[model samples]
Target: MSSKIQVLVQPGTIIIIQNNNYKVRLNMIYGKVRVLRNSHRAFKCIPWLLILFASTSTYAAFTDSLTVGNAKALGLGHAVTADPPGIDSIHFNPAGLTRLKGRQMHIKGVYGLFETNYDLGGYGEYQQGLIDELLEYQYPGSNGVIPPEAEAYFYDEALNSKSSVEGPTVMLPGGMIDIPFAGGVMGGASYSPPGSNMTFATNVYAPMMSGYNRAEDDPGRFFQERGAFTLLTYFSPSVGIEISDELQVGFALNFSYAGMGLELPAREPHLLLWQYGHPWFQDNFCNDDGTPTGTPDLNLCHIVSPYISYGDLRIEADQALVMSYNFGLLWSPEPWITFGLSYNSAVKNDLDGDWEFPIDPFFNQVLLDNMNGSLWPSFQALTGALGLPLPGVAETEAQGKGGKVNVQYELPQHASAGISIQITPKWKYNFDVKWTEWSVFSDIQINFDRDIAFLMLGSIADKLLYRGQNGIEPNGVRYQLNLQDVTYWGMGTEYQYNDKLAFRLGYENRPSAVPSETPNAFIPINDGILYSVGIAYEFESENTLDFSIGYMNSKSHYPPCSADLGNGCNPNNVAYGPYQGQDLRSEVSFLLFEVLYSRYF
Candidate 1:
């Protein structure tokens, strides 16, 4: 019997015993105790979780809705579909720009302020407790009696989570040069600042069961940390020509540069298992018998443990480049009526960057040892195959250091139409509608060069599974995002109180693109209604100064939560209060000031 056992163990057994004691201990202590408790708990609550996740994930919101050029439209509630003569007229109606009368140059600057508050409450906590009780039942308490405190800890860790307020300022600066030539020929170049903003906040929490621990109960804990920040910018230079007195055509070359920076503090919880906590816990918590846990505290300090590495994790993306083109047409057969159409081609982005990680040395060793001596080389090989830089170094240095190809992103196309009508000389009105084809923004593909790393990371197997789960195509591409065509309706009227001064009032209604099934932290979908009023002053010459102020109001409706869950703050669970499915309102007010100095050459 001894000889037979020795033969079965072999050299591999010895290595496994020596290098990975945690797995050995786990197997020895609870191997036969059933590891499916966590899975079971997940299954029990999936229906409700799916419902909430789906509803929130479906809609996409506009962090910044104001277009790049044209103060007139900006001031007129973005309702300048028909009112013309500013550099941004190309965005509304290129024909209006053609009627500029003479060669001119315009410069404008705008300061924007944004504020948002979220009110969320739900049943995530109660579900967490149920999962804990299940886990405790399957595993059995060490003392034969389950402690009520343990159950409370589980609930505390599962729900009662809050996020800090995040407000970022946006800057928009633009300039346009217009040239008027023979036969109504007007050519020009326009430059608008790329849309850019940053969001940063810190969260602190009390002790609770960690999603990483899978522990039925744990003492109070604390976690303090910061979130993510990203910046995006775009540049477009265009030229327009008039074919006849009533017909005008235009084309634009668009260029864009995007950069992202992510700095997550070191003291946050480590969702990975083995060294400290398990990765599964990051999204879930369970009991000894594998029951679902309720709302768990997500405060940063409460989640961290002494056994884990507390090193800051930073991911700074390299500058990504994309190019596209725009075409537009304007026709005015009658003096009082004008029509326009425009299309923007899809933009493809080839992103390459590194993810900087100062991971725990011990865990790194554990992972390396498991790889059978080929981790680093395999990682390098995969990076080369994907045209991506290593995950930490700058783009240039990453090319030299070598890494694996991780992911990719693509932009969508857009189409728009506008109409302007003159009702008497003093009163005029305009309308505009636009659509973006965002469904084409399908998948984010991650490629691996090394067979071992690829397999261990579940790149090949999990990729297939992920695709299937998200309705991805055969090429490992998933189009789970259900973004719909966007619609915008605007109406504005101008009252010319004599030729020197004019007052404008406009209103706009813009629908969100996000569907109702997959809401997440990134997209805040709210149908926005805008009210605007502006006054334009023209001096003796062709110079003008336009000042406009606008206000926007929006609201979102969510589901209900369970009674056991504290407040319905859990985005994953249902709401219990009378406010379930009721609207969560948000408000925004803006001020637009523009000075347009036009010089006829």
Candidate 2:
């Protein structure tokens, strides 16, 4: 649904437009309204009693998925690959810059509100031991073990509840930059010599940006507690040339700064430790006096709880410079129809930063309590006497990283094709289809400056429920992202209400790059739909203003124990294996408002 309102001031004009599949905005800007006795008069008087104020126009969310654009492109649901927006065309379709007659400038600001909500449900039936062990921890018996806070965490609160992401934030080189309303500003300019067949332009913009913070105990934190990722295209120089009467070609070199930081604790509630509770173990293995274990001071039959975490992995990395390129061509066969094709190159980034992975005390206590003294020495001697390939492996200590690190990430390449048709003298239609090569993220590799503790003990843990890396090399870890390539499209229509005003409406279907077999709270998005409305007014022959507002939403649901099916809950996942038996329902939504002003001289 779409509606437009206009309020005339003594010296200037004010207008408001509405509609998105989600989110709501009112009728008018500041003005006066009179009591109306008729429907016509009622709508006409809306401005008298209301006021609406919106600011600069631009778009930036998610990272490098082409979710960023100016007001005009967004208004048309980014179907403008064929009819790019003024100076900003340096990014969308550089060939379009050749259409500008003289020196022109475009300024845009964006107000972006992004929110994610998740519902967590109980674990599966196979995970009963997890509850029993936690119960013992909450209320110890003969053994005077310290009572942990697991009671409230599992039963009273936290689990099987709802949680949401906190307010948004953006990270740049200078550090955190926050605006009044989770917004950002960007601009561009272009110039062409008199009667020349070429144009040059530059712009500053974010290809995609998103970040979130959650309460330490928030259920959603099970996946990741806090993180931020952004790619800012601070410099892009472009050139467009009119090759012939009907063809235009262009190219642009984009240089950007990207930062990615994350912190998450790892938890694994596998079924490996439940064998100690079996009746057979106690009935047959215990001596008449009770307590008969093989190794001195070691209790191999002691029950081990699976509710706790190994420790937290905190990483903060940034790439100072990332480079990519964009090239596009525009063709006009008839006066009323135009065709466009564009390609964006992929960029690989090697980031350097600091990382720390501290092992939980519980991980150390298990080894310390049973093998406290010469028992550890005897185990080391036994392994050495056996001529084991991993000499004295049982004597090796657990480890973690707390130093410099390097990681590899790639921004996928994508291509788009668009068509624009002039239906009637006052109507126009545009459609575009795009493809993104997201499969480049199948595996993410991280290298620590030195051998981390976890890798040293990786072999033993891999024998349990985890699948180890093919080759456990020193100072390295690998996680499988397994993202899928995707294709999506959008359509838009415009009505020219005389030469001074135009109305535009658009819709786009965006699908997730993450596959269903590997979804978790971290990548909550599935498939999404975007709804948009806007008004383009040429207040003067040489100046134009574009206002656009949009809403986007995506939802996903995962059943308990999905991991049992082809390792759905892969341990190599950045989120770890905590999601194995928990049901999750997630929704991610965005509300956007933008204002773009372009002036020509």
TM-score for all models, in order of appearance: 0.58, 0.77
Listed per model in order, the count of residue pairs whose N, CA or C atoms clash below 3 Å is 80, 12
lDDT of 1 by residue, 51-131 (tens): 111111111124223524245775565654444455555444443455554334444443333333334333334333434
Reference-based lDDT, residue 449, model 1: 26
Candidate with best TM-score: 2
Candidate 1: segments with Cα more than 4 A from true spot: 1-69, 81-85, 120-128, 131-162, 169-235, 263-314, 318-321, 357-407, 446-480, 560-601
Instruction: Specify the poorest-scoring 10-residue window by lDDT in model 1.
Output: 29-38
C-alpha local distance difference test of each model: 0.37, 0.60
Q: How many clashes show up in model 2?
A: 12
lDDT of 2 by residue, 405-434 (tens): 787767678899999999999999999999
Per-residue error (Å), model 2, residue 521: 4.8
Report the C-alpha displacement of residue 404, candidate 1, in angstroms: 6.7
